[model samples]
Target: MKINIFKNIFENRFSFYRQQGRRQRSRHSQKKERKIGKLKDEIIGLRRRYEKVKKLKRQLQHANLDSPEVKTQRIFQGHKDSSHVRKALQCHFAVLGAVKHKYRGLKNTKSKQSLAQLVSDKLIKKYKCKTYCKKLIGCVSRRKIKRKLA
Candidate 1:
């Protein structure tokens, strides 16, 4: 019956440390899972953005860019006359409704205040409102054309 006192002490200490190590490992795994979740969210965002850009390209592809004379015509400011685009964008976005309410609140209305509700909400304000927006230039041009005589 040879009992080593030093070995017993070391075993007890090591067991405690091992238990602590398990907790640390659990924390580390949780952190890793959070990072993975974030990455997945970012990838989803990128995919949505890619889809939006692809859609814009597809729409632009319908343009007759080779001819300058065909630049400004009718039916959506010479862009395209098709209204079917709503079927595509309406899922992740509010189509025309997301614009004025993308930022802040709609004030006394439904948005969160009827907002949220974004792009595919982020890109709409930054890009779509300016470049790909519907009735933007068209409205301006139409306003100019129909202006009252001074």
Candidate 2:
């Protein structure tokens, strides 16, 4: 009789734990969903602010802050905001070329950072270019690639 009673108790406890596990999992997912929604809202807010700034920059150019004809014409030709996105769009072809340039040489290198350093080093050696600027670009591009892969 005692053995039967112990078996019954263990079965009840196991069943209770299974139900609790389900509840915990459901609550955790709900929390994740809420956090994701909050992040989405924050991104939307940032994009809106970026657009507003771009618009103001356009208006400033039109108001003739500099030479009227020159400013107006230059603004549309990819000199409007000076933001990352603007730089990216303006220099898309250049960056594409750079990417290709980097890719062709990355295969022999052991690590990405080393590969980037080599590129910057090579550019500096070949062109006598600005080391600081080229190094910064190399580091940033390497980080972007790492983040994208992750």
Local accuracy of candidate 1 as per-residue lDDT tens digits, 99-144: 5445445445554423334434554554344333344323233356
Off by over 4 Å in 1: 1-8, 64-150
Per-residue CA lDDT of candidate 2, range 107-144, in tens?
67556565455445433343333344455464456567
**What TM-score would you give candidate 2 relative to the actual structure?**
0.40
Estimate TM-scores for all models. 0.39, 0.40
Model 1, residue 102: distance off in Å is 43
**Model 2 regions lying over 4 Å from their true place:** 65-150
Alpha carbon deviation, residue 1, candidate 2 (Å): 3.6
Worst 10 residues of 2 by lDDT: 64-73
RMSD of each: 19.2, 22.5
